[model samples]
Target: MSISFKKLIEPDSDLASVISQWENDPSIIPLTRPNQNQEELDHREEVTVEELMKRMEHHQIYLIYLDDQLVGEMNYMVDPSHLYKKETGTAWIGITIGEPVGRGKGVGYKAIQFLENEIKKQGLNRIELGVFEFNQTAHKLYSKMGYKEIGRIDQFTYWQGKMWTDIRMEKYFGSANNN
Candidate 1:
């Protein structure tokens, strides 16, 4: 299936509802959730159209579509702390395949490829992301996509009745001359 990304501009009610539903989905939450606490889970407020619109002003959020169906969302931002101030060619990304049907397929891999191309157009040379140590599936997928594990934060999050580590991964896009 061909996957494409649509930049989320103005808020749409249907899109907002889908995001809200994904936030509350048990199957989907664990993959992206930072903690296992019920309070943290309940803290996600229903996404409102207005809120989404406001977020659009500050973030690059995109809806992932397979054919004509919405299946997931991804977003990225320039390093907020200016960690790569001298480099100025790095961005952090986050992705979620909210629909179960989209999992185990190549949807996320393709979507990320598309996002990387888009980021390159803006002169970015690298992309970075974090994945929980327990999310082996995502770790494998990212590795297949050429992301290299840069570091790990041991026992950074509490989930599944234990502490879990967060693994950091990064991919670099070499310029034509370097390649």
Candidate 2:
């Protein structure tokens, strides 16, 4: 099925409610949360819609649709590190297929393709994202899509009987590795 994107606004559209529900979802919590310290386990906490909007002021979220049905979401923001330095434009992206029916399909590939095209149109030459090391599935997906590892946050969490890290990956429009 073909996919499309629609701009997301909080506390207004019903589609926004889907995102609110995901904030505390057990499956989603593990995938999205990051523990910066071993002693502090952050479930990422649930936030009110207004709070979410405020916190995400610099970012934009788009509802992902498949045949007019909401399947997931796409989020992108100007890389904070690149805000003042404009030599090379960069954007960080996040994609989630919240609906179970959308998982194990090519939705992620399509979503990244669509998001990348949109980012390029906005004049960004670089795109980056972070994947938990334990989330090998997502890591492989990004790798398959041309995202190469730049570095990692290293050994912040222990999961599944092992210590895992946050892998930072990037895809640049021109000569990423050299850049």
Candidate 3:
């Protein structure tokens, strides 16, 4: 299976809708974003396509494709100098294999590898991400990808019935490139 990433077009309602759906997906929401508070729950703002289009302004979004099938989405904050100059930079990133077709098939693993290589070539020296304490699978994936835990928040997010911690992890390019 050939995996690829295509840059998402700006203000793409169709694609944005798909991404919105993923963000709200039961399987993905807890893993990617579990910090919503009780008050926010009552007034929870949905990730509408319009809101996603607005976010696309500052965040670089990419659609992860497994051959011809769209399986997930990944994103990172845009760094203007990271791509144009050889300046060292650190970028936090997110990935979600929202589609069932991509889960349990190593798509997230491969997607991270591809994005890391792409950013390394663009002058980024470090990458960081936060994994919820309850998500052991993601913690393991990040660990196996050479991301070392740097810190943690004791009571980071309230999900399910209680609060869970968030572990911060980072990987420097020197070792990451060799992964």
Rank all candidate structures by their TM-score, best first, as comma-separated numbers. 1, 3, 2
- Prediction 1 global C-alpha lDDT: 0.80
TM, every model: 0.88, 0.82, 0.83
- Best model number under lDDT: 1
Task: State which candidate, 2 or 3, has the greater lDDT.
Answer: 3
Show the colliding residue pairs in model 1. Answer: none
Q: How far is candidate 1 from the true structure (C-alpha RMSD, Å)?
A: 2.7
Question: Candidate 3's residue-wise lDDT over 67-153, tens digit each?
Answer: 779999888764444232223477778899988988878889988987787778777787878899999988999999898887787
* Best of the two (1, 2) by lDDT: 1
Candidate 3, after superposition: displacement of residue 149 in Å?
A: 0.3
- Candidate 3, residue 163: lDDT: 83
Question: Once model 1 is optimally superposed onto the true structure by TM-score, how far is the C-alpha of residue 30 displaced, in angstroms?
Answer: 2.1
- How far in Å is the alpha carbon of 95 misplaced in model 3? 0.5
Candidate 1, TM-score vs. the true structure? 0.88
lDDT of 2 by residue, 81-177 (tens): 6332334567888888888778887888888998898888888888878888878889999999888888777775655545678888888885544
Error of 3 at 15 (Å): 1.1
- Local accuracy by lDDT, each model: 0.80, 0.74, 0.76
lDDT of 1 by residue, 49-150 (tens): 997888777568999988778999998777645232224667788898999778778998888887888888888888878898989989999999988887
